[model samples]
Target: MSRFITIKDIARKLDISVSTVSRALRDTYDVNRETREKVLAMANALNYRPNFNATGLVNRSSHNLAVILPFVTNYYFSAVITGIQEVAYQQDYNIILHITNDSPERERAIIKNLAASNLDGLLVAISSDADACAHFQQVIDSGVPIVFFDRVPDAIKTSKVMQDDYNGAFDAVEHLIGRGYQKIAHIGGPQGLGFTRKRKKGFLDALAKHGLPVNEEWIIHSGFSREDGEADALKLLKQKKRPDAIFAANDRKAIGALMALKKSGIKIGAQMGIIGFTNDPASTIVSPTLSTIAEPAFEIGKRSCELLLKHISKRNFIPEEVILPGTLIERESTLR
Candidate 1:
């Protein structure tokens, strides 16, 4: 077996003391640039890497902020994470990730067991199953400050960062209505998510505003996934009178609806107008090029982190809800 290189090896090769080698490796002020460069070059050539877990005790208190979300596969969540990372890099804080996949029990378990003392703060985009706030409320009972983003629990009295989903959905539905689609359907997300309700309201409101009745049969509370969208779309299509258009809660569902329509020999766009929320990349690659509401995911992440930082500082920050506006991006799917 080969012997692993350490500071002692570098010091022995350089004819210097171990303390000097350590200082040089860490780029301390006492170490000269020449010596520091030599040590770094040698370390890199040897493929030496510092283990954060081992040296974290001597380093800062992990400088870590934990972010928990229901899922990470969606582009919206990915964009939000990018924003959180931007602030984390600027503020010199580490960001840890956790996912619960919308399971309420799992969400509770993760929150309950996390060492709040070790974490600087928490930024959460809760799961769809987060109907009761007892688990999150318990976090508040503890000392660690937290800020909820996107899929937050509205029932809880905490700082929340999300988009104006109602307005976004309203615009999409209204746009479809204006395009001469009188009977519009909504393939929504989980019934528990606040955004789902907001989107449903927008769909209904738009219909009512235009003197069209919101048939309860047309509204479906499916999960936020491609499969869910397909199933909901299938059920809607099988009804006595098929809806001319569908305004899905998110891009995944919208894409799913598109696939369902294609399989059933229904032409998208003018034949059956469709729009989705979240300008996910899939929206473009999918057939008919889905029109969508662009969520301010990156901004949501930055705002949530900033709000949590204020709470961490114990500055008597007031709890506030911030709803970032979304934009409408038209494409082939909803084109009339």
Candidate 2:
């Protein structure tokens, strides 16, 4: 009389035990291939759909992963989500996305009140202003596995996946030097984040390697936005000593710099060279085509999901730190 077909109905029709039918449906090692095939055939004929809720109750796993990030609309974050989807789809897992809108308070609130029973794992990209890791640590203490990606926290002992920020920034700066730009300035993000610090270190080290004096005034740290870049560039233009080249933290900032320079009638690449990190598509669309260092964003996402699954399967899994490389893409912006 039931509209929906259940595994019990298949078991009754096939003259098999309910336990055997369950094992066959699950494709357990103990269930022979012939039995599994028969169960599948019967399930198909009856149009029997799995009740994940019921199964989750018995298996103690929701098979859902949470992804918490700053902004979902950004190109880099969107690309990362694509890669995460590829793996999650293949593995029959679901993702619950949470966007904090770059708010640290919102981020903490989300993690602090997360229900452990509804999720198997978590993937995080902490906010730029997130200064505390206690909320994250609390989740881990509650027995949920977490894998941090991109904007990760330094205080937590967890798995992290990221592109090599230090080397990428080094490459961007060295490229400017190679193009015969002697005086260089760096427009970076917030001073507290790890990636920001790493990128700044790379810029400084590259300058030091080329025997250039470290101009404290030439380096500016602010929010990671196009407007921030424009403001930073305008300040630099007003300086009694302006840099001949600028290496922006990300493409958005670099694009803003380009706009500022163009308005001031400073010919890009000829008078003031520009390079940026993260090969955002806008880099190519902007006039003079901004050159940039491309981070392996997709790879970072895929690897983060893969690593989180390991933690989910094994309670004793050790934490890992993955640093992938970045490639420099040359364009008209950096050409002299």
Candidate 3:
């Protein structure tokens, strides 16, 4: 069997001590630059790889992070993961991804069973149905740094990074108002999520600010899915006094609403204005092209990972709440 190259071999070849080779490889300040360069050059030439297990035994860290997400099949989540991976790669940390499939029970089981010693930190966008956040608190109490993003738990006191959901929703509604769609309705996400409440507040506040009626029938809360959007849209459309515009929680729901309107032979854009959040890739491909409030998904991921790294390095680091702004992309769906 072939043997693996070790620091001892480099030290013997370079006529230096094993400790010197180790410090040189780690780039310790005590090691002279010239010697460190020589050690690195020789190590690279020999194709030597550092023993992570040995290093972890001494440092009490695995230098690996876990990213917990609802799913990665969508463009938004995939983009966020890309951002996270980029940062982790640059920082010399590895990422282990776990998908919860939007199930709270599964999320709880995953967190409860996670091996804390195997990970340096956690970056999570929680499942929508996760009402009990005690598992997360336990993780925090166990001294594992966790930074939440997008779907954060309001009850948890930890670092979080997300888009400005309230402002984005406000802007979306304001845009509809500017286009003279007075009888506007909203199709929102699950009621339990923090962002959903914030977005709904913004929607209601905008309508109240413009002296528009807040019709209870016009507001529908459901899952963040195309089918939920289609059902909610059909309900609003069948009302005795139907809304002239619909602002969906996300692009998927907006597309569903678009489908419902088309099936009913209602003219989109002119007769029934539509808008969504997240600026999902489907927004561009869908008929009429959904207008939306574009979230900084990639930035959210990058910033969340950066914050988690800070917590990992500094045990007593204070929690930070970062909210990035979103842009409104006016598309054919809202052209009036």
Candidate 4:
């Protein structure tokens, strides 16, 4: 293969030193803007690229951050990634993406195999419980800083960026109640997740504060999925004392429950009401637009990256929680 062009080539072509070419490429120092542009354009034309690994070796850094998550197709997570990308691009950092599909073993194995070094930090949004956090902790022990976003573990003493899931759930339930919804059933997320517990607490607390009897049969725990929503709604509707309203963990679930109820010719936003969290795009697309708690997913992702970058820049970075507040989106789903 033909030899790859380098800064040395640019220097030789421009009758300048290699150092000048390096600084020019970085647009640093007092290099003339025109010369810098020329060097950059030439490098692009020649397909010359800096070897990041070599730079990392020189700077004692990998210059790459990894973001680990369970799912990407979900609108909430996607928005978070968008936020991360925007911040990373601005900070001149590159990001690596990893997905575990909610498998604790897979999550552990991926972290174990990361081989460290070329990574500066980690942004983790876990799917499993704190019991499954050993794998995530392994990287931390190896000296790579981690900042979690969204679904974080309860035990890890690291900076976290997440929505106030408890408060968001509370607002959703309270809104339903405000609209005259009583006998409300809750379709919760997986029992293992931290956010799920927070959301469940919010749900139960809202009921208790209103003096509504906590019906054991009305609360169902399942995955954050449409099928789970459908199944839970069906189970509740079959009960002798069916709930007049449903509060789902996420918008997908809420939309699912709405579909199930609509299929049964049940009136939504009238005799029956449904509300959800996450503000998934499908919330508005559904027959009766869903009233949901909107998590600032992009802000969470962006803030997580910012925190991880801070830790990477300073080894002794103190950990803190960054809670992005959630908003309530009112629509037909919660109409009285």
Q: Write the per-residue lDDT of candidate 4 for residues 240-293, one digit (tens) a residue.
A: 998999989998888889999899888999878999998888898998899999
* Model 4 collision count: 0
Model 2 stretches with alpha carbons more than 4 Å out:
1-51
For lDDT, the strongest prediction is 3
lDDT of 1 by residue, 74-154 (tens): 799989999999998887678989888878888888988897767878899888877887877877777667899988787
lDDT (C-alpha, whole model) for all candidates: 0.84, 0.91, 0.91, 0.85
lDDT of 3 at 328: 95
C-alpha TM-scores of all predictions: 0.81, 0.91, 0.90, 0.86
Better of 2 and 4 by TM-score: 2
The TM-score of candidate 1 is: 0.81
Residue 274 in candidate 3, Cα distance off native in Å: 0.5
Model 3 scores worst on lDDT over the 10 consecutive residues at 50-59
User: What tens-digit string does per-residue lDDT give for candidate 3 at 183-289?
Assistant: 99999999999999999998999999999999999999999889999999999988999999999999999999998898899889998999999999999999999
- For each predicted model, how many residue pairs clash, with residues at least 3 apart or on different chains? 0, 0, 0, 0
Ranking by lDDT: 3, 2, 4, 1
lDDT of 3: 0.91
- Per-residue lDDT tens digits for candidate 2, residues 31-121, read 9999899988998898765545435523566789999999978789998988898898887789999999989999988886777789899
